[model samples]
Target: MVSEEADSWGLGEGGSRSWPTSKPERVDDQVTVLNEHRRLSLQEIDNARFSWIHAKICFVAGAGFFADAYDIFAISIIVSMLGYVYGNEDGNLSPWQSTGLKVATPIGNLIGQLVFGSLADIFGRKRVYGAELVLMVTATFGQALAGHGRAVNIVDVLVLWRFVMGIGCGGDYPQSAILMSEFAPIRTRGRLMTAVFSCQGWGQLVAGLVGLITVSAYKGAIRDASYPAIYPVDCIWRIIVGFGCIPGLIAFYFRYTIPETPRFTMDIQRNIAQATRDINNILSARRHTVAKGLSSDTLVMAPRASLADFIKHFSEWNNLKVLVGTAYSWFALDIPFYSLTLNSSAILTYSNFGKIDGNSPNDVYESLFRICSGNLVLTVAGFLPGFWVSFCLIDSWGRKTIQFMGFIVLTVLFMIMGFAYVPLNSTGPGQHAFIFLYCLANFFQNFGPNTTTFIVPGEAFPTRYRSTAYGISAACGKIGAVVAQFALGHTLLNSNKDMQIVLEVLSFVMFTGILSTQLIPETNQKALEYLSNESQEAYITGAIERGVPLYA
Candidate 1:
């Protein structure tokens, strides 16, 4: 080897020509080079064979997130339909009740995330993924058909079904993120996970578009009658909420074809040979016709993991460290995220859409404009820039730094909005500017902590407990959502002062979030399967310590 590179190393002519074959250091260096070359060769072979297959898997896995977004937003859009439907005849329900339809799902989501998330942790992603799709599809379609009967009050049924669907939608967050993260190549894990999550923007956009069209469909009825006829309202709502079922159907088909994560099949299942053969088949298929045979069902033989064993490896000190970090970070992150999102409808009502009046010149137009414009702005301006930032700088800027910066900025904006709300009490430029600033704050929130909190749990955990760790962390996030749903949306929106108080509280939450972020280690260069037992224990215990239990 030295002779071949003699010219480059200047080993020819007067230079020493003999390689240090007798030296242990030189022997070690040679072995290192050979091992590196062999590893690279295997990786190259795998890439050559399986790139397209992995891409297909990513696309399929990503669909779950898309559906989750659509389903979640679809429930929100159904609010307008309900307000039009139920408010017409008896006028018994308040505007709050109409909005409650939107609120009910997140309430359900809190339960679903805890329950289904636990199941995913116990059963594995593939089984839960399929089960969630089935449940969501069934419940969603049930919501659609519930109004078909003449005597049935659609409003009650809508709320009932949404809560059930929420459970399924809620389950998707952890399962989809964990599943994609587990299967992704170490080098591309961040991008792959983000890609799956980024479908959320698409889902929100779909919801807004559906809202736009549905609102327009009922505009005449809404304007002509005290409340639109219940029949038209019910029909429009059924169509809108039913949109959620599409992604579930697509996810079901995709999961049937896709194999479970090789890591999960190997590490958790302990089916090393089957895992190896699966990887080989993926690799072999890259270059030639690999047999399409499924491996023996030996992957399922790994004894079901228990909650006791789940926490079995945790040492108290390290466990507490992780528990505090994950739980605080999630809580901090959700305070701003959920607070803003839950109040989005209220924000639009009072924003540039021309004040919160039942009667105004451009009220309908303004409402439509706010929904579409905000969605477009967030989808294009907020989410795209966030994705770009994460893509370009996540490795370089680091997660903790970016997250802290985002929280600080959000806190400042919330403070401004709170002050602005105190004095600028009317519909004017002050309110307008503050709303724009608030929107800008929300945009940044999505770009930063909103995305990072989800990312951290998956990356911070070891393979053995990755699902459990994320499930518990994600359940914390929903607790934040539940708080936001009940507190910010319903409780705070009763008056402008309430909004100010809510924003003030959120400022404190964000500050705490920034502080908690200090505890988490940077995961930029870490491999998914390589987290330490101590770190894993720290993550779980830390989460439990800080997290208010979902059940409690």
Candidate 2:
């Protein structure tokens, strides 16, 4: 019998020591070894202080996300620039072309999330991490160089590349979240992971700055040209997008070198000895066996990951609910998020919050500058602050409470903006108030479900399924994003009435997210194993009575 206190993961106590006899017996030895193993693995992770390795991991993981955000959101501005250079008489892309550009990446993300997520679990995080970044970098640069061959229009070429980029972006979600969550101490896990996700704000901010800079750099040429300012405008979009790959390229080497998480090694690979040494390296000065008095390494026949095991584990409502909760919550949140976020330029103009006049060369400069300025204001005043505030309070206020509060507040804000659209935008003062509410909505989106959706799935599952489940959850969110991009293309860009309808619909969507939030457990300051709701005592069954050890 395993001891009740064998591991702090809620296993029951009381056991008798039985080493490998001529006939091997029960798991007192297995409990001791497994417990010590966890002390070195899970406990060390839960209790370890923040270190430089953690900082390095944060940058390596966050850099890819930064690139992801820059790529995705920059499209709104990119579309505007593309229209200026490539549009018909009015200097705007047709609705079909615009929708194609917006929708391709999320579709790609859906595929990447499912595929890369499982690949990471089946193969390994370290093996799968950098590949996505490479794909993203290649696709991003490819878009810049893409041309309008008669066989394939430049818009189609860009869309295809964007889809490829989306896959890479999708892969980063699970990889970064799983890696950051698994490696962090339970105490600081929420904050650290938020720190990585918060990079999205910085990415968005940088995209805006890049847009503003590129357009301004071509001001002289544009001022003297025709309405579309074809050559200068063409240069502007390419420069902004091509620059996205720089952040990813800078971090590629470090991502390639990042250590595989200990949980994956111990739980998935079933390698106790090597897992122990990994912890030892992380804690070189404080190295000592927590197993008290055990000598010689013994092979532990831990639970293995198999298809049957996966079905059996998630088949249970307890585990399935967490998955359901995470997926649906993310799905509901993204409906409004992706709709308004990616089409900010359109929404801003419709709300009269952003100023844009015509297709004239002078108008082009002003339009680009104002759109970037609007995005920057939203990022700095709303998105950035919301992320850091969540970082500070996520552990203390608890994930569930913050999620509930965020959804509720956003619901109210969206209704106010949606239902009162005419009155809110009727005057300069009214429009200013509308923009303030817009900023508030962005703030709560980050401080609330956005951060938690990314954080919870990574923490709530067992090691074997963590990345895969997170990917499923993230994919569900992208589905909503795909829907939103379609909405952004077809409806939200049209008129105030359409914007009003979408915002009203999104308020209800935010409310639905609150209900879904009920499905997930509060994962504050709990060991990942404890949150997994699995029995741990017999996790490592008995010493190697037969086959050779995986790591001796």
Candidate 3:
């Protein structure tokens, strides 16, 4: 049956065809056969039953996100401690210094997304997966060691090291998302992707908890009559930042040990034997069945991807439009997401959870506790629950609908908070009300765009370009993060009506995201091939030639 199907599409005997020395003279016939074989091979993955391999993939992939979030968010706690230790008598960071500290990692993230994303496409995902973790582990230790010397300023050292660490965090975004997406079955793809991404919430939650515990543990030391106030607080930040390395180290060996994705083997390398062997090995251990019909003898190789090929492939309007939509929507979503998230300490201060006026050691400890406690509250109440909600509903609700709903709700919440900032900030009860709305906003973000944006780009593109497209989309989001940290954050801090204006602007940004969401097609429960125009065209052509109905 397989041979007959191959022969009908003009594939040579045993489905092993010679590589043409030049561009195919008959593009349609060649493309149809290749896509058909790819469709069948990938479908096996899509239809496969739930197994331990899927769970293993999710854990290995999710560890990266957990580390990324922990590293990124630990700074929020560290920043507050920095103000206590290094701030001028006023106990505040210089606006310029704060901006640099906040924006540095995002700049590195942008570069990493572009560089590592393309590298994964060219060198293969397995080859590139764990390299980032090594950078992360090294840079994390470097961040802890910062400020140990009197000659170098702590903030400068931290900014430099965190920027390097950010590159590793950035690389994980595409590497994990594409890796899990390629391995997941279609029925659970959204849930599996969300499972990996949901670790981000825990990372944030753990960051807050760690900050709370670390500072509390040193509370007695801060109150000691002999030690300087700066001494105990300085150690707090280092411990929090250094703790990020644990998850990365735990995940590194597993990530490195995993085989290259089966899709990459079949679709890019065109090595059916290796792809089949890998798939069957996974199945034998986890599914009690093995892949059948793939020849173990042939080693067919697809043309290597190049800069020109990338341009030619994406030059088509259909391909370009999806890329633009994913990129722009992610960019739109991250503007407010990162701006608010990265600066949650300031928001908590504004909400009156911590003391803004304190120079004494006892006062510093009290302030640190309050801030860390507030962050923990927000994480537990808002961030973690939001992620789990999305994890539960993303597959059922569909990515587009959930994203649209999230953006719209976020728009309304931001507008309310923006327009009502003065009244809300004025009274204790009003502030509590404000925090509730803020938590709801966080919930919608996770249940909405945050989870969907990551999942969609991972699944929407063809396997050959999946990581590259995810990288571009993620890179654009980081650009938004950079703009938020540097541009909007700076403006909000400088402006007289800081909270009001920031919230209003973020509301407007969310509204624009709704418009961008329209460009992306619904992807829930669909085959990856159906999402790619090139593959879909070939699949349909081959189906018709074989007298199979279009639906089949």
Candidate 4:
């Protein structure tokens, strides 16, 4: 019967060679059959060559990240413009309002990661993927239209819309990472994941460029003596915020069209027929002839995952330790990472790198331009290169070593910048020195913990719980971001007296991240099944008992 079904499907004699001739008569045989099917499905994915389909997957996943980065980082620039239009005597965002604006998205992000991450695992990746992008597009437009009416305060409206946008952004993190990781061939899985994440650098760059262009375009209006310094009240910042929706819109179609990853379809959903069809479609699209020739009737659904199952799987000390390591390392990394990246303009301004000469409209415009320009230079010099370096070396040098080095180096840089805060901010040469350290810190962030933290969670967990574990780890990181933005950013970094203290604390945080790195096992040049000891043991034992070759 199996041979006939395989023949009818054009699989021929070779295709049915290993398929069981009858239903498994015993419990262990049943388990072995199901495990072998899953193992083969994953091995197929891991060994497949790179193709245009892979590129499509990367772009579809990457576009969400681009939008995420643009929306999150654009706020920093917009805040500067807001201060110009609605400046009090201080002519800057008050620490309280700044904290609210910065922290709202992360709060929303925490909820999104928890909700959507679990949903992806339960409902399947394709079903839950594009909805977040839609939410983001709507919220981004709302943010642009915010403050148009007099009834609500502008900051409150922004806080509301941005918080919702943050949810969408948060969803993208797990969805994109897992989708790309699942689709990627093992030989370049790390690089592929890194490639998708590298979109963040582009988004950061675009944010700065948009700020510079919009502010520059409106410079003439600001320079008009007849008009007040804030004459074009809604023009500049609205344009900047509104521009973020473009990438999401462009990527929406592709994201919606992307098929469910074969691994998810087979391993989690336990639908071998559909999984095989999807894989064949991908191969056909890529002009490859290999097909799994799996029969839907012969394949049985795995038990649906539940909370109890989740607990049972992760309760083991080894699995629990991985979760802990990923969560805490991300937390420690983001404290300094978010605080620095989100507030780069403020830092530069505080350092007098782009000081405003006067309260004139022209002066304000130029200062915004200079600040944007400074950010662009730093992002281009340090941020983009770091991602590319990781892209090149992630699969070769391995994740653990790079992450450890990054934490160590970043710790030293922060400590130096912290203790020498007075000197670094004083003379011209000192300012230059401080800027170099800051840029270098940004470099190591992408080259090390920032990129690795995001990648590790997606790879380390089993498919049934991959999205959920990734989400939990990510949410923990956002918790760190919230603390940094609200707790440390608002309180300590707000005033000059406490700036050094903030840096010193961040240095300590990075060092602690170094300790957490010890918990992560190296995953270089290994298949996903081999990453976790349980999965590796199952694959090895199953292969031996069934008299089949591993990776076959």
Candidate 5:
């Protein structure tokens, strides 16, 4: 049997010889540990008879994604309503003003992501998670009560409030993804993470539904020229924005009760006693058998790592490469993803599917309905498949390969939309065909880069720095969001007939994405924990062998 000191040093010690010590031996030990960990993780999953706890955590975190999607999209709905309130009596607003309101929130989103994301890493996920919820609620409610005049000049106030809310929303992306990933079992990691991530689709869908409801409420007022009745238009929009708060409140209340991750506790908190109990409980609950030699008191744990130590751990070249690759992929995904959503109303306005104030009765409602219909279809198609793909193939196919496929397809789709739009065919099958291609692009985004970009930041980092690393990566992504939001409105889709111009801009951006993706290595099958002492040594040494810079 292994002695206390031998076990203290782990499998490499005790000089058992057969237990693994050299590099090859260390690889063998990793296989053994991986096999054991995989089994234990699976057993724990089966035992979590309170699987609903897992589901609840997922839902709570996911609600934030939904809110982010909804809040961002609301900018478009409100802009559409604004056209009716303060445009030509015939009901059309200038494109520049329309674009400004639509894009301002994304700018806010970028700032929020960077500021709050870093906080999640420095503090704990639970604390920041709760605070962000309160911020989101306050800002959204603020938007609801902005002003009522025909030319209500609260644009600055609305923009600032949205920006504040965005910081909270931006905070949600990393916090939720990291939180869900930690709670998930390895085998089901993809499923749980993707499921939570897919909440964005639900949020978008809710936005579409809300748009439909809002439009329906105004249909009567809009149709009757004489009555000119007010339809809680501002309140309706407020309620939609305010709706995001309910889920956040629920998440905040429950998040306090949920324990920090056992892996996090093991890696960062160094509370081995509690970590061991949680780990064993997770395993025994699933397998219906006690751990053979494990006891809470007997379990040895690593010391809590300091921030300096954490940075020191990743001072190697390859580590930095992986970090850069992951961050770039995230940045690449956001440019088009956010640009499309933030500018979707402008796209619809130019598409001319219907008019806001044409001669026809209920024309605005019809136009709003069509946009919502398209969004609903796209969300269901892309997000639902994402959950399955991430669940079944993430480990098997690997992260880099899956993301590569996504980027490549996205590139091709963008090119298709670009070519279809170049001539700017105003009327006929060409325009309709262009619209179809645009919808297809949205579909591919959901199935491909959208899911993978978010997934990688969570999977790539160790638990101790998971939130911090994710925040950094997510902040980079929001930088892209800010650029897309502001630029697309000013340059890409600035004109009513520039649909093709917008497509070309995104196509150019997506090509760069395909190239940036080449930097990432495959990581699907690798276990998240430390492999072995020799392997850890090798990780440090291998980088030096290749002349990779070490930070510390």
Candidate 6:
């Protein structure tokens, strides 16, 4: 190899070589240094013992998801409240307007995923991490403050702000998942990521708790006369929507100051020396500060990311399959997941849960109370437990195993619910059985594909494309949510037999999800590099001195 390189360069006259300027030996030596340092740091990260840093990273990154979920689902009951405030004399929002309000967030999420997902890769995670939370916090507050403009009703204002908040909500999926994946130890990585993603269950539960609390707080006014007292009803929704921002506000500083993953600092920035120093500070001392002798000029130019490089990497079938697997699995899972979550009130009402008979203010109070209480019960009975169960088993049982099993169970549950809808709703006891089945579906979703889809994409791709790929995958899931809200949600609001058909459709989607799960290789207890399916040798090709970029 040396003789061939010498022959190619014609370094033969007296066997003397060009020295100092653009020295070939310098490039080779730098490659060796990059390889050695990168390998050591990655080993340290993957095998490092569990510590407070891991816990801190889990919660800080996860706080965004909690806030996002709270805002997203809180709108379910809030839509009903807005109906009292903004709806016409009929005390109802037009079906189109209601769907639009509910669908806005998923639309925003799709945009945020595509935009911020790539930005984090191009700039840096730390720079992009807290940015979406800003959008969430600001837009959430904006929703709380929305009022009736002469031309635009409060509903229109809410749709606008919720869409913006949705974008921020969407951005959190990739950002949080990528951060946890990059920072966590391999053995405990799945559990840590699960712990982070499980915040959604708690968020949903709290949305209901807050909804129930607010409705009860205004109980007297709601029961006094005709429709729910408009002022208190307005107050209820605002309080719930406004409260969603508190978590984001609290975690904003920590997220902004969060350390960049050593993987990104090494692989994307190409600074292995600095990356090693980062691993030491984070793992050894649990501090986010960088070591001394930091240089602004250092640039390790090894396989820099580009449009062509990204295309080439994922073009391989092995790589492309995983991306497809994660994307479609999420898409399928969310078709049902969001269909149920975003429309839980409608679905529960369809189930005749705590049904009442009159149209008076007392009737409205009883109905809204039932909706809030039922949501809380569903969440407590199903969502929270499913999340913790996944948390406990993710590391041991493996992601694919749990996903496959969950999908299978979910498919069965949906089929039974759809096929037996008439019989299930025929009797009071049967309706109770139907709700039990409903809760079971919720349980399997969190315990199954819902959690794993978020996890696999974050870890499956290479460091350079990790955030971008996860964004794409998560964006696809949001697309499913959008479709469900726009198409199925609109249909289900009819409160008819359509839910039977929706359940059937969900069954089919879950079955397809099962097929997609076949494509996702098990990410259980595996190193991120192993999942990337890329060669590791000679990872450092060269260096760019003094702020010159090797690849734009």
Ranking the candidates on TM-score from highest down gives: 2, 6, 4, 3, 5, 1
- Please provide, for model 1 over 60-129, each residue's C-alpha lDDT reduced to its tens digit, 9 standing for 90 to 100: 7678777777777655445544554565443224656654666677677667767776676656677767
lDDT of 2 by residue, 438-460 (tens): 99999999999999999999999
RMSD of every candidate to native, in Å, equals: 10.1, 4.1, 6.9, 6.5, 8.0, 7.3
| Tens digits of lDDT, candidate 5, 1-552 | 212422332321233222112222343443343233333432343223336667878878877777777887767566655555555555555666665666566666666666666676666666667677777878887877777455656666676778788777877777788777766655556667778887887778788787777667766655664423235344456666677667666666776765566665544543333554565554334223222332233222233346776677568756666677778877888888877776666666566553344524455556556656655554565545555565576656666677777778778877777676644456667666766666667666766677777877786766666777777777778778777766665554456545566667778778887787776655443334431111322121110112332111
Q: lDDT for model 1, please.
A: 0.61
Model 5 residue 384 CA deviation in Å: 4.7
Model 4 residue 244 distance off true place after TM-score fit, in angstroms:
0.4
How well does candidate 2 score on lDDT at residue 230?
A: 84
TM-score of each: 0.78, 0.93, 0.89, 0.90, 0.80, 0.91
Candidate 2: residue 370 Cα off by (Å): 1.2
Among the numbered candidates, top lDDT falls to 2
lDDT of 4 by residue, 1-552 (tens): 112322332222224334333445564664565555555555567667798888998998888899999999888778777776665654576777777888888988988898899999999999999988988999999988876347767888888998999999899889999998888876788999999999999999999999888877887887874434775635888898999999999999998788888878776766665676677778433322222333453334344579997888889989899999999999999899888888887788777866375767677777888888988988998899999999999998889999999999999999999999998888999989989999999999999999999999988888888899999999999999999987677764366657788889899999999999999878665666566545332332222112332222
lDDT (CA) per prediction: 0.61, 0.83, 0.80, 0.80, 0.62, 0.82
- Candidate 4 C-alpha error for residue 375, in Å: 1.1
Off by over 4 Å in 5: 1-50, 87-96, 148-152, 225-232, 280-283, 286-314, 354-363, 380-392, 422-427, 530-552
Greater TM-score among 3 and 4 belongs to 4
lDDT of 3 by residue, 28-108 (tens): 654444455554456567767778888988999888899999999877778878876787776777877788888888888
Global CA lDDT computed for model 6: 0.82
Cα lDDT, model 1, residue 545: 12
- TM-score winner: 2
lDDT, residue 225, candidate 6: 52
